[model samples]
Target: MEISSQIPWSTIAAVISWYSSNIGVLLLNKYLLTNYGFAYPVFLTLCHMTACSVLSYIAVSVMDVVPFQSIQSRTQLVKICGLSVVFCFSVVCGNISLKYIPVSFNQAIGATTPFFTAVFAYLVSRKREAWITYGTLVPVVAGVIIATGGEPSFHLFGFLICVSATAARAFKSVLQGILLSSEGEKLNSMNLLMYMAPIAMVVLLPAAILMEDKVIWITIEIARNDIRVVWLLLFSSSLAFFVNLTNFLVTKHTSPLTLQVLGNAKGAVAVGVSILVFKNPVSVVGMMGYGLTVIGVILYTETKKRYRL
Candidate 1:
């Protein structure tokens, strides 16, 4: 069967959007927190959630990007809140990890997301894939391990937090699938962001304030000193909203496992981009590891197509 016949243009568009926005946000977050001396991951993440809330609201309510979806039941509302909580945690942890690690190494750690996603899919939803399909993940993960060995700036604390963030991300994907599996509970990507973004802000605000001292004042001070910082924040926040939107769209059109598979390829691309943008040193071993990941992703895609899994 032809690939185009199997996959809709909208799904491909969503995937492309996801790749661009995700990479852009990660790079910006790294630059802001580490090189740019912003140094407040939690507060920065709060800004992203705030942008998501406001932009998502305008997109849904005023622009009519998708039909407005009200919380149907107490149960659905609870599920959305739970998702928001996880989303907030994952994003903040991801930002914090970037403060201590290079984006390339960060992507190396993030490559493990497929493993966590596959495990969570089984445990949370009892979903299973063919053994052959599972085999494809080995190279995807092994490549990351090889890349990690090549990283010069590996921090144990950063590595741990990145792993935690990756696991949280995988769990969120599986949880979203389980919580919104019902026909009535299912929401379009835009509408889902409309509800999730604000709730995530509510969940994140207290933690941001408590963990980061004088963040508001510091942000203001930074903005006053350099208007460029303000522009960067706005640009990063806008990218963050698109990141969430495209993520939901991809997960909606495809299974969580496929999303994770795509993410492996994405990690390889991120590593390449980081090298170019930041001029981070990558050993020959790292490049070889990335090559393996690319091969694994292609094999995974072919396996899915051949077996129609």
Candidate 2:
């Protein structure tokens, strides 16, 4: 399919915007991790959802585009709920993984999502992918293995959680792609997010209540004492909105494999920042692994051109 024709200037702009937003999110997440601790994901989700819901309501009220009463549809509702669950799982695992690993390492490993997504898509959709696509998987896997450095003492549970988060993200991408492709031309970024953010917020609420406990109350105390926490949460929420919108746009504009390449770059950027800003240590083995992973991504991208895979 000629995806370019499907994605107009607005979509391209959204993609760029989303990319910028993701970078901002990375920086914000790093700072928040250093200051507010890892539980920030729960708080971040809560604030983002609350803010989006309020903004959406205001937009609906002012524009009166579709009557609030008339906006309910079973299919849309279902899709929203599905997307929400996927988002929650992805974020929870991802957030937790950060507590155990540096952002850069997490991103490098996460870049393997395209390979996983392809594997999952082939199994679930029964689509026949080009053999070259399968070939590309070699370097992707190699890169991840190299980046991980086979550290015997590494946190196994944390690594597993991060991998699960990556898989969840990949699944979400494939599902969203299917949804967009089948839903006609009206499935724009804002529309998808409008439905997704609220549902995700709803899903997160109970999880936060159950997990946060007195820590939930503590976030308030922290926010009051350190105003930066509040700002971080607000920034994190905005970043979430931007990242979700851009990610969907990228999927719509380019192939899933291309998105994976971007993911690789994002991981590198995060790692670079973590090392510089947070002084996170990068061991020699970890550096070697990162090199292999990047090289694998390059090889995979180059291969995709000749094979349409």
Candidate 3:
């Protein structure tokens, strides 16, 4: 297909929406992380999933869109559930990392997700990557190490969690791509969000209830007192649904590598917002790492001549 023909307006709109939502999510997530604790993850996830599910249900009902249906098979249901579990864990770890690290650093480090995704795609799907893609990882990795000042003493556990989260995110993208491609249909973000939100909510609800010190009733009471929390919850929920949906649309429109590159840009945007809006601290080393990461990403993009599934 021609380049213009390949570009889907819906995908473009989804990506723009994703970026806008990321800004809101980063701001709200930073507040929750700095002020509250990991509990914010559970709360944010539940709120967003619930809101998206409700909205999706309304849209489907009003518009007479695709009806709620079972997965094509039991195996598919199992895979979706498994992927959702991994997604939940990844997001939780990512949220936890924000407490110990600057948003920019987190985004910069997380940029490695594209590299990891490319590698994982190669290994898992037997897809071949351009030789330059491997070379591009060197600077990306170097930048992350330098950006963190090679510090061994600063929130080692948090850093590790973030790294693991990035890896899991990369894996999730690859798995999502495989599943979506196998299905062989262009699914709108709202449709996919409708299915995944309720399922993920079901999976996460039990754990949030059991592990969270605050019960549902108590949490609701607290939310009543802290109206900002309620607003944040709503914003976060909308953002989650939009972001994931845009990501899927982008993957369908462009190549996985392209989507990964865009993801890195999203991270950088988050970093910028964290510093400017939240007054988060940054180091000279972190700045250098950020610069190098941009350079590496540019190199990868230039060298990449083809976009494949």
Candidate 4:
């Protein structure tokens, strides 16, 4: 009873929410892009941003879920817009990779995010981790290399794009931390997402139009023929909002490093689900590599936690 009383139920709930939303969006995305033949990654990402913009407004302004925050200055608005660009790039590349790679392989690559986060932290904030922490990243890199060599359906283009997306994600995380670290500049997760979503729409619009061409009309036609596509898109967009919201909540309740550790575990879960659902071919080497990455991430997290003490 005493141990139960000490448990942080709220934080645990937030983490579960984050995992469900993250995995749902990811798997749905893979289904839409690969199996469903919706190959327009940019347009799909644009749809996601549009959903986020509308849903975020409804939640904040209409439902009063969280307190609304207004942009205080031009500088702050610019920073939000800048962050939106990176966010858009990260999301689009991630979606594109789904078209070419299995989700299990993608998750294996994603487990390396902590390594990129460490590098970006130093480059952006001049913050350095302990030597032991840096050493733990060694296996993270080795694991990805092994996973890459063992990927049955490895596409170089896909691998490169996935890696870029991972790096961009880390950079965005670090940049957000630094850019909004100030008390005056800080906006709660919901508000930050609320502001960034519309900006992301603006950024994604032209890219979708130029690169994807008439894919939007194709998506509409498909939706008209099959209502399931519409339902899928709607569900995916809603999940995306929850992903961002729960991500912020988790980080708020715990810490960013905790988020990273949870994320690594989330990657393992995603890998298992992807293999089960998609039946993607996997080799023993690939699984071993992914296991190594997970272990490295755990060590890295522990090292950071102990160093802080």
Best prediction by TM-score? 4
lDDT of each: 0.85, 0.69, 0.71, 0.89
> Any runs in candidate 3 off by more than 4 Å, and if so which?
1-16, 36-39, 59-70, 150-154, 183-189, 215-218, 245-263, 306-309
Question: Which is the winner by TM-score between candidate 1 and candidate 3?
Answer: 1
**Predicted structure 3, TM vs. truth:** 0.80
Candidate 2 achieves a global lDDT of 0.69
lDDT of 2 by residue, 1-309 (tens): 687787677766865676678867766765666544645566566777776665555544566533343224676567657866897788778777776776777777787776778777877787656787677678778867876774433567778988999899888878776654553323555555566667878788887787777657787788678887777787777676657656766777777676766666766776776678667667777777767767766676676566763
* CA-RMSD of model 4: 1.9
In model 3, what lDDT does residue 59 have?
64
- Which is the leading candidate under lDDT? 4
Deviation of model 1 at 174, angstroms: 0.6
Model 4 score (lDDT): 0.89
lDDT of 2 at 44: 60
Error of 1 at 281 (Å): 1.1
Candidate 3 has its poorest 10 consecutive residues by lDDT at: 180-189
* lDDT rank order: 4, 1, 3, 2
Positional deviation of 117 in candidate 4, in angstroms? 1.6
